[model samples]
Target: MDQHIAEAIGRPDLIHLDERLVCLRFETMKVVSALAAVRHLLDTGAVRRGDTLLDSSSGIYAYALALACHRYGMRCHIVGSTTVDRTLRTQLAVLGATLEQMEPCSDLKLDQKRRVERIHEILLHHPEYHWMRQYHDDIHYLGYRTVADRILRAVGTRSLTVVGGVGSGASTGALARHLRTAGPGADDVELVGVQPYGSVTFGAEHVTDPEIIIAGIGSSIPFGNVTHELYDTLHWVSFDAALVGSVDLLRRHAVFAGLSTGAAYLAARHERARSPERTVLFVAADTGHRYADTVHARHEEAADITGLAPQEVSDLSELALPWSRMHWNRAPAPAPAPRA
Candidate 1:
């Protein structure tokens, strides 16, 4: 029996959408990382039970860190992006986590920048507070080892393709890294990362999506933990395309997931079609409740996903609008671009 609610919430459900395609759905995915990270900090004497843990988040990570703090007897201070909704705000309050939300802004880059700046300011005020660098620390990867083992047990690593958003690199990167440890057939496990058009993490920063940049999948800034070499391929999915994929997923497979999941679902279908021998498992990071008004309610506006296809590109410079795919081939990270 699990001792804490965080453990239960972190546990993902493996649902087989088809013989070869699977959905690894989470209630709120980052709880795995947050709980493990906090536990590790306490174990290492880097922090005490009453120590305040600080971090910046868009939405999911904030709630995740709060839950972790609640379970571990720590205080959580979150510098939240403008995307943090009222429901999450109330939950954070009840969980005893303090949130410093930025002013409302649609531009993903600006919101992320503001949140980071706020985090730095807070650290200056409280020098003793521990900053849980979720974006840069490898400690976040520790929790996913068990998850990878579970996946390997259910669907052996033979010709396996793990698809998910390239968010902070903890989930997908850690899963692929741990899966590769299962001996012989481990080398066959391929990691395909899905990103938004404006995410700088994979060189898609040059391209701008007219609509919202799908949150949590991609980043406006560079993440140190994102081992670019772990990824075998890349898919830059726009908001409209992700919406269509999300709608199609619900209509067909009954998986009501977030924008990033929709993007991963779209990419997974494409990967599966190309490599029928591979068992494609994509991550559905969270539920669809938060996106109900933004995505599901606009189901009528969603285009027919069957008619869509990604524009394959050889270079980042060639990345286009609705969808684009590139063969990363376990390459090193691209040189950093000058920040605006």
Candidate 2:
């Protein structure tokens, strides 16, 4: 018998796209990570059989926590946004996860805060429920260690650069930290973070770009799990670029992934182009099957990114980012430097 659903969580596919790049494809990456967190809570005696699990998610994490709770015989609650689509709600319903969505906000930042506020209300009313603190807790970081190990074993003796969405800081931040210590050519491995155009984390002007549709990679608020030191460089990818990458990924590799995955794919391509010698690894967090129409109607390939002005570069030493206010520590940028 398959005694544990949690056993099915880790060891997602690591596909070598080419000599220079690979994709860490997951049916849902957070399912793997959330399982780790839940297991830790259980083993540490933080919670028992009767206790309930709770967290706030825009979408993915809610499904993940629900799945984890269902497998572990625990109850789950999700504080979500109005953006919580019918599909996800149905999945959560079947999984027996309760979702309370906050009022819709025209601005994403306000929406996130409202969700947090709702979580507070839920916690106050039901003080017995354990909050997973997906944004603020380090336990979420521990989940990605398995992924880092997988990357290490797959690309032994090669230079590597890990790039992906930095939402809540848990996935990319945690994965990069582990990869740094144990990955091949550990000393030289580069860690790059990708964010949306207006995510407060990267300090792009708070004015949300209508074109940037990727989520789960950037945030309106600073996430505790996203440690600034873990990243060597950061790129703020626009939605158009992410869409381009997403569609291209489907066409070239038949890898169906979400907007965040596309954004990460875009960043990975940028990294690979900058240094063809080093291997690039990026995660495709979820299936793009839901996005069937997003790229299928158009058949033309995405344009090549020039890596020019307004493009995200590693050196904030020269660029003035609103979030960093020029306080971010500087690192000399890797070569093939973009001309001013």
Candidate 3:
């Protein structure tokens, strides 16, 4: 009876990827956010005892919410995305969260719409159930203060650039926003938002399916929190690019992280190569255990992943060049963090 599972959440050990790049392996980041959201509800009497907490998630948030509710003695129900798999189902069951999955759909936007619709239906039937509007709610942003503070502590005030998927606008946006004012390196932190090819967030056409193998990173739907201003530059990663990065991550660092992590890793490499002396940090959003079936490629040859994104493109497939990258602003003055 450890009774401290929540303690394990979000206290990730940072790993060095290169001289100037690091990975914050935040597999449990969602747990931190979920707990913060739920605890706020309970503390403010937003929802009373026995009230079911409901939300939609395709991946880590589902398990994260389940873990939060289980520890807090609150009943939880989840409307999971169509892409959620059997592995997550088993994990959710063990965590005691009730789940109603949407009908499987390939289109990302449609799948998101259907999940929201299902959530509305569930709300209509059970009005008492508290819906944690994770995407749009500012409460989702509170948990990352701890994350930003940790980075500031580990690496003193410096001009650090943070990169990661811009899904709900919660993780990368929230964390970067927090760091700007409070992080030790708050002076000139640049945020680079990452999205898969074809995501509507960065104004790319949805005619072709998004190359996002994992859900929750890129949404075809509008994300109210994902502000364009937050990210100075945007990188649109393709499935092939993410797969390439993921393979290299496993073979090189043995990180075993997800597609989102791979995308961040790729962006970090690109940034690091562009300016070797600057501190570039990225989020390893989750571990890759859930992506074992499709995203990994044991057969691919490994290389020390370097900058691939030469320029942003309208058609990710048409480029047929390398991974896409764009500079949204002039490179800020570099200030390296103190060494351990």
Candidate 4:
């Protein structure tokens, strides 16, 4: 599976997963990120000799843009949040991309609208910069489609329950479009989207006071990539559940995934319980190493159903498995040593 995915991205180290859902084996984000940027430039006719491109990104997207800028010989300017990883920032700077950090929100809340506004302001200050606004770009979807294609091939079945969280919703929307237009067989696949409980934007009922921990999952406003018409169903997960899912993945599967991936996994399990016969595929967006200080720090907290501050939850060792018993760690014991 990794070999196939590597070939698609033209990088042998482009995939992180092995046959078993354990710790990541490679760094595929770099490949996918670059693919997204390059694909966007190609499809939009935005690429030009010495064209200066600007992007507002946190970390993963910034890495991609840096790679794209280097490959295309375009001057790149990245508007990033103060919370972005230092390693990523250093790498982007080392790649000759200009880095600008936006001040943290006064309310201590990281709002997408505010981030976009800040980036817009930066662009205004530098009129020469051409913003590759991800929210409005159709080509971003093409980059994410590669992931969906890999999922389809991995399962070796056309009928699947595709599940993932929606940050910008480009990936989910692209998967939906691919399934819908591919043919009669495509109809068998269902796309399930997961959103944070507090920031449910797509027909989800619950909405709590906003918090900034879950970085790549929530949005303040509907994006062009999120087409309700394409989604089959949407699931809302609490911060606590998402945290438990993250810890559970680490303890059981050895898959150190981010909170958004955990949220999506929880949603997938919920869907799987309703339809156990279907093959389920979910995206592991990134590793948890990046968020060790935040989500991973308070992972053992009790499952809080009430929409309160996450810190209020008490630490509990045994997590109540809300979904199923199919944990990552419960692999079957090897067959008993063969007798004579």
Q: Model 4, range 65-100, lDDT digits (tens) per residue?
A: 777777667787877876677788788888899888
Candidates in order, TM-scores: namely 0.98, 0.87, 0.88, 0.75
Clash number for every model? 0, 0, 2, 2
- The best candidate by lDDT is 1
Which of 2 and 4 is the better model by TM-score? 2
Error of 3 at 307 (Å): 7.9
> Which runs of model 2 end up more than 4 angstroms from their true locations?
183-185, 294-340
The C-alpha lDDT values of all candidates are 0.93, 0.75, 0.76, 0.59
Q: Candidates ranked by lDDT, best first?
A: 1, 3, 2, 4
Q: By summed lDDT, which 10 consecutive residues of candidate 4 come out lowest? A: 310-319
Q: How many steric overlaps does candidate 2 have?
A: 0
Q: Which ten residues in a row have the lowest lDDT in candidate 1?
A: 331-340
Candidate 4 residue spans exceeding 4 A from truth: 1-34, 39-44, 106-111, 203-206, 209-213, 302-340
Q: Write the per-residue lDDT of candidate 3 for residues 126-231, one digit (tens) a residue.
A: 8988989888787888788888888888864376888888888888888888888883447588888777755566654432434453466776666666666777
| Higher-ranked by lDDT: 2 or 4 | 2
Rank by TM-score, descending?
A: 1, 3, 2, 4
* Per-residue lDDT of model 1, residues 30-90, tens digit only: 9999988999999999999899999999899999999999998999999988888999999
* Cα error of candidate 4 at position 218, Å: 1.3
